[model samples]
Target: MLQSRRRLRSRIFVSFALFGLALTSLFAAATIYMRARLEDQLINNTLQREVENFVQFKQAHPEPDAPWKLSTFDAQIYSARKFANVPFAWQRYGTGVYDIRDFDENGKLRPYKLAVYKDDRYWAFLRLDVSTQRLSERQLITALGFAVLIFAGLSMLIGRWLSSRVMSPVSDLARRLRSLRRTGQFEPLAPNFADDEVGELAAALDDYAQRLTELVQRDREFNADVSHELRTPLAVIATTTELLLNAPDLSDKMRDRLKRMERASRQSTELIEALLLLSRAERSGPIDGETTDIARVCADVIDANRPHLGGRPVEVSLRVESPLAVNAPSSVVAVALNNLIGNAIKYTPQGEVVVRVQDGRVLVEDTGPGIKAEDAEKLFQRGVRGEGAVGKGAGLGLAIVRRLCELYGWGVGLRPREGGGAVATLDFQPRR
Candidate 1:
């Protein structure tokens, strides 16, 4: 099964951070928009009212000008006969506020808002300078930018806090699971958590672990029972074969048959022991101050599998370029070598099967119909056979060999040989 590289806690934290940033950005933008809109409306309404009031005041006292009294604004009145006195830019506009920039008498640029109201006989203009308002707008923008930064920072801190709180139970569960793997103990997981999603997950894992523990226990007991029951009859056969071989009246052919029986019994016993170790997923180490002779085991396996040739002109040879001994059980070594040599013998029709032991590895090279490089690895899988496999077989021999090698921390692989054959290599780690 595949899993995510990123942790759930990290994803949650990032989601919260991004949401905070987006929310703050949106809020800041809306604030700026509303402030600008309301300011514009207020300024326009105040200017319009003032300009109208000035017109009404003029109309009420029509003798001397009410007062050329304008504090924040410059007011001007133009009669219909004095239309030319109105600024050409102001002459075209009617009865509304207009923002205008122009060169004044001092040859300097002046920006202002103009409020204009007109009738058939008179025109009223009110001008208000806006430099201070521009400065205020820039200040407001700067302030909002800082506010966005402050809130975004606060959001990040809050996200980290929430993630820690949310993931604490999950972290505890993981630590407990690691302890279980290291110590091989089972413990309930759900009771420590609240009634939440994490608690439900813990309950599910507890149930699965219990079922798996039971299944493994039963499998181990069955393997032990089978090994004990089968070893007794095999031990009897070995003893009987030795007794029958020692009889003085035994014929040469009868003695050879008894010797074959003894060899078969020994092979079966070794196979049983090796398989028991495999079933328990236990590695069988070498005895104290002793190591398994790889060359000797290869020779014995080659002799045992010669019968598989079925009278074909196949030559099986062993060459020890450099003697190798491994710190592992002889039976496991023997079982792994047997499959490699046996497969070579079965596949080679009329060629040579060379078993070479050197450099803490065994190389079985066979000159038969070679397998494709891609198909070599598949041959080690259970129930998988080569394209031109001969005779009846379950295709499990190589798979078992692979399992044994894996248990013992050894490496096994196959590749296409240069001279149209397959080369199987079983490399063992060097003993310390």
Candidate 2:
């Protein structure tokens, strides 16, 4: 039996969600990297310009005895001796731009950009406070992290919605297919789906439905024709055998042979009728609703098969519990019970074949050669004969029994007996 393991919608949703998350994460990382590079370049250029301005001012003033006081918009200048008041980290920096953390006059940690210039006469150091820039960068990173999270969540929701939309038509098609099995009615599917893969699938299903409907129609017609054609000849044979048995001067051997012929003809007619009923039921649902007595049918089947027993010492017995009744045609019940009992009798050469009805189930047990564990189930299928089968049969008796049980919503099973032979049970309770 095939089992549905997963849904297409879930797979599609997860794929889209992962793809969106990866793209969003990559974009966020790239943005953060570019921002850091640009921030560093801006800080370096600002510090270099400040250093150049200080050099130009020194050359312009040329005051050897002037008080060393210089001010810029963004940076503070200090000589090597005065720069000692700055952080030790800043003083240790060479003649290059560097970012460092320092304590201000208020003893608060702050970020600063330091530019150092050394010459033969004096060493100059320029310090620019970048606490605000660092604070802004931290805020940007925090905001980007939250944005990425929010976007990822939105992508999941969007992916779920899109997957549902994409798979809706396929789901609808599946539901229609299931409905077809129950109702045997076909409706066009292409009109309900869009012009995509789903539409193509619907078109294919419609074509298959049309072809299957035609095939079934032809099969039913063929079965009906064959039933009609065969029943005429079987009726003549049954009538001729009945007439021959009625002759008063017939010998014992001739009478017994005629009786066997009559029994065979009757069985053939009953089988054809039952098979025709089954075929009709397949096309137009279960049409036989008449209730039948289980014990009566089993007794009739035993009497009908007595001729086939011939010289075999196999004894057949029927055990009925409380006169069980089932809602099915007498022919259908007879066909199923007859096959079970007939197989039991045919297989058991000398031992007893018992038919018992109890607890809404009919069990046929025999003392024949036991069935193989592996072949127990396979014997119920068409064209499959049990390994212990003794007589020449087309291997369709149990298959017909199974079909009747299925058509009437009953349950049938065959299992190996404890010591020998097999037990076939037919439960009247409808299979759910």
Would you give me the overall lDDT of model 2?
A: 0.77
By lDDT, the best candidate is 1
- Residues 278-310 of candidate 2 have per-residue lDDT tens digits of 777752232566568889888888988887788
Off by over 4 Å in 1: 1-68, 87-95, 102-110, 118-120, 246-249, 369-374, 387-391, 415-421, 429-432
Q: What lDDT tens digits, residue by residue, belong to model 1 across residues 1-432? A: 112334555656676777678767777686778578758866776677668867777888787845645434788999978999998989999999998886654787877899999999999999987755765677667867776787678777777776775577788889888999999878898776666666778899999998998999999899989998999999999999998988899999898778778878878998999889988888868778589899989988887777668799988999999989888888888888888888778888888999998887999999989899889889999999998886788999889988998887788989988978889989897244
TM-score of 2: 0.69
Each candidate: RMSD: 7.3, 8.4
